[model samples]
Target chain A: MSQAPSDIDDLIDLMARLPGLGPRSARRAVLRLIQKRGKLMQPLAQAMQGVADTARECLQCGNIGSDDLCKICASEKRANGEICVVEDVADLWAMERAGVFGGRYHVLGGTLSALDAIGPEDLRIPALVRRVTEEGINEVILALNATVDGQTTAHYIADELAERCAVTSLAQGVPIGGELDYLDDGTITAALKARKGF
Target chain B: MSQAPSDIDDLIDLMARLPGLGPRSARRAVLRLIQKRGKLMQPLAQAMQGVADTARECLQCGNIGSDDLCKICASEKRANGEICVVEDVADLWAMERAGVFGGRYHVLGGTLSALDAIGPEDLRIPALVRRVTEEGINEVILALNATVDGQTTAHYIADELAERCAVTSLAQGVPIGGELDYLDDGTITAALKARKGF
Candidate 1:
């Protein structure tokens, strides 16, 4: 027929709903899958099934993993008495890729948003609190984004854990290899304010 | 323990191999799939399985379909003598989306490229030649891309099918609604040279 199969069209529709993909990109992706069914599509399908069958949010930190408790939560090496808190799993993954932190993480699920009506109970704040007390955490590092809602959530967490343990946020400054001219006014101001001895 | 599972890593690596997707995008896509495994990832995996189980290239036209003879090849309505030749299935899908072509299509798979060592034999050119005569084709329309290799392949096919049927190529000019300032010199020149009386 002149039109594509309804299933293929449905697949494209679902693909377009992904984070960075639009309808045009989804169409191209479907075509690529069709063309590479044996080499790529089949394998991709199998992998998705594998992940879908096993992937679950960590019971302790809200991180995605195959088990109820993620690898980080289960590992004794990552138990450094310091927990980096992020607003989402993507940020957790980004921190993991950075390979700097030897400690574990706690995902907040999302930032506090008055407009979206997200409250403390909706996130994993209580679990984080319990973890801080039980694990004898020395510090809670707020790795949330610098947006208003992110900061609001971070400040709320800091307030909640202030009496229990030391709390700190990531430093605001010019990024590594960042050009001064390209930096926004807010970033420049933040960097200037947070400046320390070289 | 901190890193993602090998299966997920494999999925991300395979996703990166798709056209238009890089490593970073693939990572984002994989994470999104993990987060939405029940809603998006499961359905996507099922769709892929459905396509993989049934999808096969049309023996006659090289179009991807769920059947031995694609819907177009099987349909009596699409048996019109006009065969629109394209470089790939993506072009076929694009033309289909436009809903202009009512006849059948011949997907060449790829263009004739000497540097890449791609020849007529590598494409479906021989099959196209056979279809032109056997299917009682009245015209062979070359709708290949405007690129050099596409033109070369079109000309080659035209020369081969010249004695069999009426050979024609798609008209080249400034695209409809395309701004004059944005068009390249070659397109403008061709549009000017091909100008007809009002």
Candidate 2:
């Protein structure tokens, strides 16, 4: 049967493929956009187009920015000789939002996977190794996830940079807002094992 | 603090205002888009722009379309002396997806809300009445929502068009795939009240 004239329906289909939006949610969003076309939808469309046209991956790091080199990589004051290597740009943005880490970041794009045939060459591991020596980094913090692939990638990076610089990792423990009762078995064990002075 | 380089952060903020997305989800979605610029992001941006530029509400009915008259409104085959009334374009799209109603639709944009200062003039109720006589509509089916405001709007329309045409509404019963055990009290009562012969 014929439907909402291809263009609108196509937009709905694409919106449904977004991270948190399902078919029902996407339809509602599209309708909302249509209703507020001048105020919301048009501006959203323009912003997306602007971002799509300008956004690019940093040559030095994998962080997304409007230029060839991201702001973190371009800034001279941020060269604090500490590099936080992350698995995704989302993690880098998360780190930036926390406002704790003062040094620069190196995004690996994704972790190495045997099932997916993604190796060190597939990720930014080689670029990271080169950056360690070129930038005179003192410490390389592996801010990867706790997943099997994430750990494997972290370990691989640590091994690769064993001779060049001191390698470190994020402290494995209960999250800041986590309760011991709700904490997973592994996290509880790690938090207890790594307990510090009161 | 200068968070996320302005442009990216702005996009995230705008995306956060969408129907089903929050700030965190919008951030994740933006990162996802930035990561896959070529495959997903660019296409989505283009689609949004396309729909934004083309989509307009049908002047007669409130249905969204690229032109003044929507396909359903323009089509002669769908002029089956019936006009289905809905609260939003999303509801219209949902009805289209179901492919059950073989007639045109009238989108009221929103239900009557006294608290919000919404009234008959605020909705498409007057336009619906005009269509009943102009289009020789034998039936005006009220496919409004099940909410109080929706029901209030339905009853108001039914009262307005009592002499003009047959005012009908969607049957309230247990949905096709719905289980009685999981049904809410109101739905159960409605289903029992509207029970038909076996």
Candidate 3:
């Protein structure tokens, strides 16, 4: 018996690689998309193509945008001499949804993972340092996750910018080993408001 | 302050429309793609495009495939005089993952809906009746969800196909209001094996 064409199989294969989706789920998702091609799949395809054509990383703060500088990085109002350093864009978005921090953000990409051999250079640490001096940033708030690697990265960044700017971290609302993406908007708002010096 | 670029906003807006995704999660997902443009985003874009270019519904069974007929429908070994009818591809996949049913599947795309004004003509019910008579099918197993709409559709199909073939419906394992997608493999297997005549 003949199988599905190679392209459909390829699509299912790629979808299987997504987090929380297995081969079975991938097949079902592909089938649903095919069934709703005009409404769901076509638009999804157009969006993906558009993103592929224009997507790029923000040079100043490691955020993702269509240009070299993301909207937050380019905004004059966001350049309030304060930068919130986060482990990932998800964390940055969590903070944004809370609507408490008017300052710009720096996405570190990931934590300092010794076991995985991910160092400061592998993240956006150097870019953060450059932004601190070049943009005349006065405060750097560390919003890394509460994991071991997250804390290590936070401490490293604090020590690196010790003399140049006031270094701080989000306070008590963040739980132990918590990722910012999982935090409620209220908790994030409280944490940002009660941020303390590292 | 200026907002995110139009294209980026469009992509995020489209992503937000997906099941279980909101504007905040959409933004986070989009941002992650932009950050890992080379490794993750590019491949995802290509996959989506490939599927869009090649995907089509199986002419006979309404299953998504790259060809006129899906693999299950095309397979001679699968045409064992029995066709397992399901409300959705998710239900079909649940049956496949359980690996107990040897017969092929006919995906109905959706159940009958009065509130939505959906009827037999809107679903694959006519095509299913055609398949039973044309393909010499002996049995049709209804593996639909245990919802009011699902049972209603099942009864409708059974009434329509009463003369041509023996119609059976999956038994007790599926909880009320539970979708087949949420059921465990073992439960689906047991339910399929112990299916009762309708």
As for DockQ, the candidate ahead, 1 or 2, is 2
Task: Write model 2 residue lDDT over A15-99, tens digit each, in one string.
Answer: 8888999888888888888878899888888888788889999999988888999999899989999999999888887788788
DockQ of each: 0.57, 0.64, 0.33
Predicted candidate 3 versus true structure: per-residue lDDT over B53-94, tens digit per residue: 777778988776778988888889998998999877667656
Q: After superposition, how far is residue B129 of candidate 2 from its true place, in Å?
A: 1.5
lDDT tens string, model 1, B11-39? 88988887778888888898888888889
Query: Which residue window of length 10 is worst by lDDT in model 3 chain B?
Result: B1-10
Runs in model 1 deviating more than 4 A are none
Residue B20 accuracy (lDDT) in model 2? 96
RMSD of 3: 6.6
TM-score for chain A as predicted in candidate 1: 0.96
Q: List candidate 3 stretches off by more than 4 Å.
A: A1-6, A20-25, A76-78, A97-103, A146-148, A171-198, B1-4, B75-79, B96-104, B113-116, B146-148, B170-198
Docking class of 1: medium
The native-contact fraction of candidate 3 is 0.40
Candidates sorted on TM-score, descending: 1, 2, 3
Which lDDT tens digits does candidate 2 get at residues B1-61? 2267688888888899999999989988888887778888889989998998999989989
